[model samples]
Target: MTSEKGIAAVEFALALMGLLLFFAIFIQFFIFFAANERATFAGFAASRVFSVQGIGPAVETSEKIDSDSIMTFETNRVAVARQIPMPSGINNFLTQGRGFSIEIEIPTFNELDYKNRLEQDDNDF
Candidate 1:
């Protein structure tokens, strides 16, 4: 019947809309996760530079990551902080400035101390 066909078309349209909305949400979440991964990698890379080169070079490298991220490093400690930007409406209702922070400690190396520890362990065995 004509009425039956109309009802079926309406239901299919509604279902299609729902499916599209779900797909959009999935894509948004994927982008968010990718951004997070990049931020984390940047933090670790900056920390490595700080440990190997020094604070100045590390700070310079971190500055290239993005405007939303912050990096700081001292003699033996490095820290990176990042903020995730969400849609303006969602940000207003939810907690503002959602972000992550990472800190790494650079180990100090002392050849004499290491050698002494090794000898002590050898004597104990």
Candidate 2:
């Protein structure tokens, strides 16, 4: 009589599970990378607008860029909120002074284009 060994079956199952786990982690990393790229793009766009024409221009630029991209941008003056000590006389001016900051938030890859490719139906078409 011949007996079949279960070692091969167990090994194959463990290997398959490991492969699935690896793919899951890889997908997560890819999504994070894509989100980071989009966020950086939005920040750059906001900064460029602010540098060229100031905060008022930044608002319009952000609106325009937001329309074209898959991220949201917000501009604000946060210098006042910082814990840095203000100079005696300059404190009053600093209170009214407007420093600019931009926040960019991007959605996940699943929201933009799943399956690892951009949609051909975009305006580029």
Candidate 3:
């Protein structure tokens, strides 16, 4: 009876360890996914601002997203980047940082040129 109880306890401990490991991995994956989503949202928001308000304000808004994230603007495009924070225990082997970068292009429009083109099209018709 005593030996059987010890064996059961050992089995339970092993199962518990496996469960803990799975939980840790789940948490890490959740963090990576959430961070990527946030980075993508920030990129789109910045791109929207760039399309409407111009580059300066858009860059400023993106820079304010988060300290761990980076935002860059090039011509009519904006990109937001971020790194996911992993749990300390898994840092040695899985310490590989997960991150996401979202890039968006905003089209520029010339109102005068567009109007002229429209008029020429109407004349041709």
Candidate 4:
């Protein structure tokens, strides 16, 4: 004497649980996509400022840009963008006097004998 009413209720509960799981996953994916997009846009915006004003002034501008002043995503996006200059390798090349300099070897062919691979790629190729 089993009726189908209990079976229908059980099936409905299972389907509802599955729907909730799917919604959770979708929301998580949406958050990740938004974060990645923000990071990318921040990188480009920071790069533009760097290209225009170089590293020191760009850092200063970022500090001056007042995080609370703007409610837009771009303001919050590049909050830590100024740290790129001091990233280990380039620290030695930057002096404290507000200018950045990197020794990009402008080499002719065979200039460093066997060690100018980077210059060859840039200048020759």
Candidate 5:
């Protein structure tokens, strides 16, 4: 029979490489999801802060967010995103950053009240 020495070893090595590649992909997805979850939480937290802090007289009180803190409140939530475990070229195909940024929109009570008043006036007519 022909020499088949180290054939099984080569096959095993190839299989192991495939498994490692799959595992790397799986881990990257996990990281992406985890970071997304964290970003979501931060969004909610930022909204809460905006709502709670941008209350009555806050606009008058603070120089920033003045004239209507509720309306003028602007901030950004930064989320650290992870690149898929791959070569630079492949990773670039996936994404090109160590993180991502999210902009949170907080409802302005003044605008809501103004709209509500307009609606009520229209209803009265």
Candidate 6:
């Protein structure tokens, strides 16, 4: 009877540990999804800004880097919050202030034969 009680306690302890681990992973993935969506928005915003106004002709060299700090639209704090909590005691101790960035060679002016197909589609209608 005593052995049964000990085994039950052990099983419950193991189950609790596993449950906690699963919950922690679930929470991390949830936050990852949130960050991904936010990043998509930020990328679209940056692209829109450059596609219309362009990436040059107004650069003070410090104004357009597309990072979280450079682009205010990228306000997702996941990169800041999702730090690996180890290897502490250094200059970057608690946080690295890491963030996402968007850097791409934005082709323009009929590049890739990508004409305004919408105008042609409108004629069909």
Enumerate clash totals for all models, in the order shown: 0, 0, 0, 0, 1, 0
- Quote the positional error of residue 117 for candidate 3 in Å: 14
- Enumerate residue pairs that collide in model 6: none
RMSD of each candidate? 4.4, 19.6, 5.0, 15.6, 9.1, 9.2
Residue-by-residue lDDT tens digits, candidate 3, 12-125: 999999999899779877877777766777777777787678888876776677455677766556666565665555665554443333333433344566699999999998
lDDT of 5: 0.48
Candidate 4, residue 120: how far the Cα is off, in Å: 15
Task: List residue ranges in candidate 6 displaced over 4 A.
Answer: 56-115
Poorly placed runs, candidate 5 (over 4 Å): 1-5, 55-90, 96-125
Clashing pairs in 5: 81-99
TM-score of candidate 2 relative to the true fold: 0.43
- Per-residue alpha-carbon lDDT of model 6 for 1-125, expressed as tens digits? 99999999999999999999798767756655665544445444454554445545212222333233233222221111122222223214424543322332222333223455766677889
lDDT for each residue of candidate 2 in 54-93, tens digit (9 for 90 to 100): 6666556555644333323334321111122333444455
- Indicate whether candidate 4 or candidate 5 has the larger TM-score: 5
The estimated TM-scores of all candidates read 0.65, 0.43, 0.69, 0.45, 0.50, 0.50
Determine the C-alpha RMSD for candidate 3 after optimal superposition of all C-alphas: 5.0
Candidate 4 — which residues are off by over 4 angstroms?
56-125
Instruction: Give the C-alpha miss distance for residue 81 in model 4, angstroms.
Output: 9.6
Candidate number achieving the greatest TM-score relative to the actual structure: 3
Which residue pairs clash in candidate 1?
none
Residue 116 in model 3: lDDT = 100
Model 5 TM-score on a 0 to 1 scale:
0.50
Per lDDT, the best of the predicted structures is 3
How many residue pairs of model 3 clash at the backbone?
0
In model 1, state the lDDT of residue 9.
Answer: 100
lDDT of each: 0.65, 0.47, 0.69, 0.44, 0.48, 0.44
Residue 52 C-alpha lDDT in model 6: 46
RMSD value for candidate 5:
9.1
